[model samples]
Target: MILPKNNYLKARNFILTNARMIERRLFEFHFENGTSEGVFHAVYAYRNSDGGFGHGMEPDTASPESQPLFGIMALETLDEVGYLTKEIILKDFMPYFKSITTEKGGIPWMFRPKSEYPCEEHFKTVKEWAAISTTAPLLGILEKYEIDIPWMKKAEQFVWSEFERIKEKHVFCYLCVSRWLTFLEHTKSQDKAKKTINNLKNWISNNGIICEDKTDEGWGLYGKPHGLNYAPSTKSILFSLFSKMTMESDIKELISRQKDDGRWDTWYGISEGTKLEWAGIQTLWVLKVLNNYGRIQY
Candidate 1:
């Protein structure tokens, strides 16, 4: 089941040549024993004076302006490299979170980027509304470090209440469910988290959030996450929801999807400017997941 050495090398070359500096550093950190500081320095390049991130850190938009989505991506990168420290959270991040937060204490999924920046057309359509999609994961990551800021109380309240209200048909984005699971994983209320997770498992089982058939071309429907995208590893709470055969089929199909250039296909639309950048990011993620499943050899 190991990813062949040649395949790994091709992906390594693709990342080194085409990936953004941050993603390149991340690749090195994960596979080549590169230092976390290298990744941290690369990540810092994306930060704005407003204590937030931008400059296409997420690759969905090349906006230089600070954004909540970019901030989340930055946090995710830091978390991946084990640099999501208390000081980093407080000094580098909390202020930005405080600035963009709504009265409801949640951050919006996105803000309309200025017209000048090159971005996918979807950016123009995003509404500036608070999102459980954005807020829940942020809260979960913060709580992982036990960093209790004033902002978290309202956010925690919002996430908890929203999870309580969410129904099967009401769910649209599958990724949001992952965020909800993350919140449940770290929240102090273990009893509440367990109950909520059980409810979510039941809901997603019947909901269209998971694609059972691996061959379905619409698996990436409009760039939505796939079943494996939600549960990249066996450790994920959602992993058990899929049968062994389903997981294996999805993983086999995923490994086969790697292009001759060593990058996997993105389910979403991408502009010429972002195609390679997104590809590089997607390749790194695929390798990580394969490694997680013991499909890659050291």
Candidate 2:
């Protein structure tokens, strides 16, 4: 595949710079500006504070602590930093994985205790969302550690079962499909992964451009349906890149959308009436995908 040349070198340099920033933060653990403690600290704080992870808010940001679903993003950031390790993976991170799952094998979007007020909306009984979102990261972490979590295996089974349940209706969001594909990739289930990608591609092709919402069809933010679409975080871009589903025309269009500064605004999540910044991390992520696919050029 021929890679686009525009800002390739600049993007690479930018990623290197950010990687250094991450390194410094990890070492210092108290960077004055920007997110503190790198991925390790973020994961530790998020799990301890919120009981689950999402995008919005930092672990150490403020009071009434909530877990940012972006914990998965943090892990992705750690992977970019080359800081992902078995010890850190198992000890500090995996515990959060356990909390998100219920006895019936359901995983919620957020996982604070029942006593938490507004935070309660974060809960969900949907096995599909739980397995796709939670288990994907769990699987990714396990693959990183080369150690298996039995619960994760059950989670995978649960996800596949739920996926089969919904495959006919095609009710899943593209983001869910993308994450499911990611989990399948980690588990080395190429056939199942490819099937999911084909289904997503079919949906996107027939449904017009995937925008943040059903209203705008042009490159939906993150996945389909409007409310969930957050343009700034590069969730859509990363998902496309990782799934290897981008058509040449689509990729060129995405390239055209790149800001002059070589960054894109992507949303992680919202917390305490605030959105988290994840562009730098997202940029590095996309660049890594392009590099691996031999799609990066100077």
Candidate 3:
């Protein structure tokens, strides 16, 4: 499958002209065949004095205050650009993570977002949001990058125990379930991982995640198409639901959705600043997903 040519180029040029530096670097690395080290360094600018990423690296938080939730975001970016390391993980971040570790050993989704940070009230005051989303991905990163930290080992225990507990827990959020499944993939087991994967698939299918809206209304809070846009993409939901047959059509529609400006737009929170950053991120994410799906021939 091929990405739209003129639209993609216009979008590319738009990104070059209007996107943030970090986003420009990501586009260069992913689409222009540029070095990932550029992304590596650009992301580092977001790194706080305490080692955790801040300065709005993830865009929504927009604070210099370091947070472990951003640690998950940072590690994801690090892995994408080939820069994950214990030195990177331990120097400032791990200590901060240790500081925030709950008595039960789980991390918080975020420590308060800075008062000046521009986002939803929910994000601003999401006190003690479940760490499952952060913890699962962080544990997966630690495992995939082979950081070998004791806290990570403990974190793994938390992940497993939490997942087991949540099995009985009702009304799971798609974000947490998605991350939990992600961690399970990186976690230490073939049989258990496979079992969890199947269960996630069944759960998603049973829960009606497949959006039936088929209209503009389906694009939820973030302008993402359908029921839940939080779990990476529709392709991901398809994977969990065992709906491989629809992937080709989904990819085609995704390609068609590329706007004439060459960017995929996301209607995020109130701030223009936040929207711009999120838009840049959406463009990079789209390119990455297309590449992963083997649709971009270049």
Residues 12-48 of candidate 1: C-alpha lDDT, one tens digit per residue = 8888998889889988898889999998999889989
* Model 3 Cα lDDT, one tens digit per residue, 1-298: 5785666677678678767788898889878788878888888788876667777766765668777767777677777777667777777467777777886677888777655756556676577845677888877766776677677766777777776777624323554565665677677765877776776666555665555444563243232233323334445633544345555656666676777677777776368877777777777777776777776744
lDDT (C-alpha) at residue 100 in model 3: 76
Return the TM-score for each candidate structure.
0.92, 0.58, 0.85
On lDDT, who's better, 1 or 3? 1
Which candidate has the top score in lDDT? 1
Clashes of 3: 1
Residue 59's lDDT in candidate 1 = 79
lDDT of each: 0.80, 0.49, 0.67
180, model 2: CA deviation in Å? 0.9
Better of 1 and 2 by lDDT: 1
Sorted on TM-score, highest at the top, how do the candidates line up? 1, 3, 2
Clashes found in each candidate (C-alpha, N, C closer than 3 A): 0, 22, 1
Q: What's the C-alpha lDDT at position 196 in model 2? A: 67
lDDT at residue 178 of model 2 (Cα atoms): 46
Off by over 4 Å in 3: 168-178, 217-241
- Give the least accurate 10-residue stretch of model 3, judged by summed lDDT: 220-229
